[model samples]
Target: MELKIDESIIKAYGFTHQNINIQQIGSGHINGTYLLTKLPSNEKFVLQYINTNVFTNPKAIANNIQAVASFLNQQFPTYLFPAPLLTVNGENMATYNGSYWRLSPFVDDTVALDTLSSPKQAYEAAKQFGKLSRLLNGFDSNKLQATIIGFHDLVLRFEQFENALANANTAFKTKAAEEIEAAINYQYILNNYLEIKDVLPDRVMHHDTKISNVLLDQNSYEGVCVIDLDTLMPGKFISDLGDMMRTYLCEFSENETDFSKINIREDYFAAMIEGYLYEMGSILTKKEKEAILFSGKYIIYMQALRFLSDYLNGSVYYPIHYPTQNLDRAKNQLKLLQELVDNEEKLQDIINQSLLKVI
Candidate 1:
C-alpha cells in the first residue's frame, strides 16, 4: 500500500517534477525510503533519507557500497548491485537542509517481500545473502567502514545493558524482574561470543538480513539481490546468518505482543541452513562452521539485551508504541532464545546435514 508523502523532497534532490507521485516504500525501521514516479514520463527512482543519528556517517555508507560495487563488477559483473546514483555534481550522496539523500536505480520487475510465504523463500533469501558473502570473500575487508560501530558487537551491547540496568529506575527494574533474570541468564551467549569472536574471520557482511532487505523476482520469488545497504559493513558471518535465523525461523515478528504466536518453525530453520551453507559451506572456516547453532543465540540474545536495555533506560533508544513495548519485545526475544536453546542439538544436526549436502 502506498502512503501519502509530501513531494517537497523531490526538489531537495534537484528533481523539478511538480506532479510526481510519492509513495513510502519498504519495511525499514531506520530510514525513510520513497518510490517517486514522475507523471507523463513515468520515470522512477528509489530515494532514501539516511538516519544520520544511527549511522553518524553517510559518506562512509556511499563509499562502502561504491567500493563493493566496484569489486563486484570486476569479479562478478552480472551481479545486480544498484549502487547509489551520483548527483548532478558527480557526488554519490546529496545533502539538502542538513539531511543526507541517496537516489538509486529502481529495479523494475522485482518485489520486496514483507513475509516468507514458504520455506523456499527462506532458502532463497538465505542463499542470496550467502552468495553475496561468498562472492565478496576475496575483496579487501579494510576498504569497508563500520557503518554503525558495534552494530552487531554482542559484547558491547551486553555492557550497555549492564550500565542501563545499573542506572535504571527502581520501579522499572521491579516491573521487569522476570525479564531481567532472563537477560542475565542469557549471558552465556555473550561469554561464548567473547571466546570465539577473535577466531572467526570478519567478512563483508550485510549486518541486517531481514527478508524485506531482499528483492525477489516478482513471479518466481527467487532472490534478485539484497537492498537497503546502509547497514552494509565488515562484520562476522553470524550477523547475517543469525539475523536470518532470528527473523526467518519464526513466523511472527519481535513486536508482536502475543507471545503464543511466536513459536519456532523448524522447517524454515532447516531450509535457511540448507540455503546459507549451500553458498558459504565451501567458504566458511571450521571455526565459523562450529558457531552455526550459536548464530541464532548471538543475534537473538543481543537484540533482547538491546530491547531490555532500552526498556530499563525508560525507552530512550527504540521507539515505543505503548508503555512497555520494549519490555514486551525483550520478553518476546528471550522466549525465542529459550526455544532456540531447547532445540540446539536438533538444529545442529540440521546444520551438519546441510554442510554434508553442500559438500
Candidate 2:
C-alpha cells in the first residue's frame, strides 16, 4: 500500500493548512521526511513516515523523541526544534496505510547544511551540540531503550568481527581471515575504553553526531540546533566525538575502493577536536581527556570490523553497492584507523591545547 498523508488530519492537530503541499525533502536511509507547506497561512511543517520495519517499535521510538523534546522544552524553552503532535487519541503516532507516521511543528527560517562549508560552521556545530548535551545532563539514561544492542560498544564489535571470520564462504574466507588477523590487535586499541569513565562526563548521548544534522542559520552561518534524534541514547563522550569526526574530518569518500588514496585531514581533525573541547571540556573528566585520541582509533576499528563482518555475511546489516563494497568500506576505515594510531601523539596535543583554551 502506498502511504499518503492526510491533509485534514494535520488540521486536526492545529496546523490549520487550507491548501496542502508535501514535498519529499530528505535522503535519510531510514525514515521518510517531507516538507509540508500550508498555502493559505504560508506556514511549514515536517511530516515523517516512521519505518516500523526498521524501528520495530514505532510507539517507543515516538515516545523517546517526545521525551527528549519535552525535556528540551523545559530547559531551553526559548529555542525550538520540531515538536511532535499528539493525536486526538493522546498518542503521538498514527497508523497510516499500514505504516506509522508522525507530525512535528517545524522551525521556520532554519536550514540544515549538506556540508560543513567553513570553520565557523564547525565551531557552531560543536557549540550547539554541546548545548544539547548540557540540556540533557540530568536525564535518566536507563529510561531510554538501546534501540540496537551494542550500538557503539567496541567489545561487542570485536565479537562480531570474530563471527565474520568464522562464517566467511570459501571464496572469500582466506582473504577475510587475513583481514581479520590484521585487525586482531586493533581490538586492543580500545583496551582503555573503561578508563574514560573516570575523567569525562556522561549523559544521554546523540550517538550519530554528523555535522549535517546541525541546523545552521543561513545569514550568519551559526548553528541553531541539531536534528535527527533517532539514535539518541546513553553513551560516553567518545561515542559522540568519534562519530562526529568519522563524518566530518575525513577527506576521502567512505566507500573509496582505492585504499592508497584514503588520507586523514590533520586540519579537519584539529578543527573538530578544538570545537568539541570548546563545548565539553569543563564537564569532561581527566580519564576522558587521556582517551580522547584513542576514541578516534577505537571507533574506527569497531566500524571497520562491522563493515567487514557485514561483507563476509553477505550484506545483512548495512546497504552495499556491490559484492565487495562492504569489504572496500572496511579497508578504508581500517586505513583511517591506522592513520589515527600513527598520529596519536599529535592528536593528543590537539586535545590538550583545546582543553587549555576552554579552561
Candidate 3:
C-alpha cells in the first residue's frame, strides 16, 4: 500500500520538501491520487500516478492530458480542467520508482460525487456534461491516441469474453453460463455500432463520464468543472452518456455484492438526460435520440461481460476482493441492464422532453 514518491524528487522540482505535504486521495480503483498541500502559502495540487498496468504508455497518457488542457486553456477560459503544472525541464510528467507521476493545481470550491440526493443535482450534473460536449466540438482527435486499444470495441470485447469462458477451469462457469448467453444475445443489438455512431455528433468526448469526475460547487448544484480528462478523445456523445448513466443510475451502493439489491433510478435517468440535453439539444439528431436507450444497455452489458471474462481469465484485468467478486459484479451489471431495458419507454420520454425544452 506504500506509494514511492521520493522527497528528493520533490525538492529537485523546486518545491521544498519541508513545506509540501502529500496525502493519499480516494479516487477509483485504477489510478492512485494524492492531494499535495504546500505550507506557508497553502497552495495545493493533485499529484496522480498513472496506473501502468492498465495504461501501459505513460508518455502517451501525459501527452494526451497536456493536449486537452492546452485546448481548454485556449478555447474555454471559464471551464476549469485539471491543467498539468510543468516541471523545471518544461515537462508535465516525471518518471519515479518505475511509475509515471504528474502534478496539477488543485481546484478549490469543488466536490466530487458522494451521492446524488435530489433530481435537481442530477439534472445540473447532466446539463454541465452537455455543456462540456458542446464546448469540445471539432477538436483534433488524432492528438489523443487510444492508450488502451479496443477499449470501446464491443465485438472485440465479446471475443475476449468467449475466450475466457472456454478457458475457465472452475465450476462457477457452469452456473453462470445462461446469464452469459443472455448477455451475448444483447451484444448483437450493438453489432451495427459503427453504422449508428454518426447519429450522435462525434467530437472529443470524455469517454469516462462518471459523476465523480465532475466537481460541483458546494453552494450550487451546478457542475464547476470536469476533472480526470485522461479519456478525452474522438467518441460519440453516447459513450459519455452511457458511462454516466451506467455509474449514476445504479441504486445499489458501491459496496453492494448481492445482485438482488440492484435497481435503476428512472428519476435519476430523467434528471441525467435533462442535464445533458440542456447543453447540446440543438446538435443531436433524431436517430441519436432513438438510439440512446440502446447505448445504455450496450455499455452496461459490455462491462458485465468484461468483468466476467477477466474473472474467468484469473482476475487479471480488475482487482478482485473475493473469489466470487467478479461474478457478483457481472450479475449486478446485468441486473442494471435488465432494469434499463424495462424502463426504455420512460427514458425515451425524458430525452424528448429535454429536447423540447432546448428547442
Candidate 4:
C-alpha cells in the first residue's frame, strides 16, 4: 500500500540527507508509522502521525516523551530510548495539515517480536520494563500529562461496560448474553481496584506494556529498549504489570477464535515474575509486592470488559476485522482470565519464590 507522505513535513525536521525514501511499517493500531531512510547515508528514522482523536493534546505526548527521555539519559545513560527529533523550529513535534507528526532515530540491529518465542525472551522483556519503572521511580510523575484520561481506571471501564450493555441493540444483546454475564461475574475485580486505589502508588507507567513494545537485540535476543512512549503517564504499577501479563503470558493473541489456544503459559509467567521482580523488587513496598500476582487478573478482566463493551456499543473504540471480532476477543480474554484465576495459587507461589531469590 502506498502511504501519502507530506514532503513539507519531512523537510520541517531539517534533515541533511539528500536522498530519502519513506514506507509504512509495523502493525500499530493507534498511530500511522513509517520508516524514512536516507539513501547515500543509509541513515534511518521512524516518523509517526499521532492519532489526535485518541490523544487530544499531541504536544502533551511530545512533552511526556521529551521529559522521560531526558530523565533516562541523565539517570540511566546506558539505557536506550528513542528520543523525539526536534523540528527546524526546535519543536519536538510539528502540526502539518491538521495532523501531529514526530520523528526519532531508528535503532538498528533490533526486532520487536509480537509474541514470546522463548522464556528467556519473556524474562528480558519483563526485566527491561521493570528496569524502566525502577529507573524513573524518582522522577515526578505529575510532570507528565495523561494522554488519555481515565485510561486504566477499571471503575470507569466497568461503568462504560454497564452503560453499553443497557443500551445495546437487541441483536447484540441477544448474541452476547453469555459474554455479558461472564463479564458481570467478574465485577469483584474492579472492586479490588477501588479498594486498593488508596494504597497503590501512582508511578510513571508504560500503560502499553505489550511484548511488541520492547525492542530485542537481533543477535543476543536481549531487550534493548522499550518503545511506544505515547502511553507514558502516571498510573498504578499494576497497570504496567497487568498489561504485560495480558499480552505476554497468553499463548494466543486476544483475537484468537480457538479457545483451546488461549491458555496462559506458566513458564512464561514465571519468567515474567522473576525478571520483573529482579529489577523492581527492591523498590516495591510489602503491599505492592503482595498485589503483584493479582495484576494479571485485574488487567485481563478489565480488557475483557473493554472488548465486550465495544462489541455491545457497535465496535466504536477498537477496529474490528469482522462483525464478531470484538466478541471473539472478549471471549478470548475471559478465557485467559479464568485460567489466571484457576492458577492464582501457582502464580502467587511464583511471585513469592521470585521475590525470595531477589532477597
Which is the leading candidate under TM-score?
4
**Would you give me the overall lDDT of model 1?**
0.88
**C-alpha RMSD values across all candidates:** 2.2, 2.6, 2.0, 1.4
**Lowest-sum lDDT 10-residue window in model 2:** 1-10
Question: Which structure among the candidates has the greatest lDDT?
Answer: 4
lDDT by residue (1-359, candidate 4, tens digit) is 23466777878887533578787898787789889898777789999888888889988888898999999889889888888899999989877789888998899999988778898999999998998999999999999999999898888999999999989999999999999999988888878878887798889999999888999999999889899999899998999899989998887899889999988888999998888988999999888888997798889998999999999999998989899999999999999999999988888888889999877
The local distance difference test score of each candidate is: 0.88, 0.74, 0.76, 0.89
After superposition, the stretches of candidate 2 with alpha carbons farther than 4 Å from their true spots are 1-3, 6-18, 194-202
Ranking by TM-score: 4, 1, 3, 2
Candidates ranked by lDDT, best first?
Answer: 4, 1, 3, 2
By summed lDDT, the worst window of 10 consecutive residues in model 1 runs over 1-10
lDDT of 3 by residue, 275-338 (tens): 7877877777778777777778768878888888876787886777887777778878888888
* Least accurate 10 contiguous residues by lDDT in model 3: 7-16
**lDDT per residue as tens, model 2, 1-359:** 23466655565455544567777787577888888887877677778887766777776667677888887788778866566778777778767556777777777667787666666777777777777776677777767776656888877887787787787787776656656776876756656665554455557887877776778887897778888777777778788878776766666667878878766677777777777777777777777777678767767787888888888888888888777888888888888888777777887777778888977
Write the residue-wise lDDT of candidate 1 on 39-157 in tens digits: 77887889888888888998999999999999999999999988888876778887766678888889889898888889999999999999999999999788898988888998799
Model 1 error, position 147 (Å): 1.0
TM-score of model 3 vs. true structure: 0.93
Decoy 4 TM-score against native: 0.97
Model 3, residue 219: displacement in angstroms? 3.1
Tell how far residue 288 is off in model 3, in angstroms.
2.4
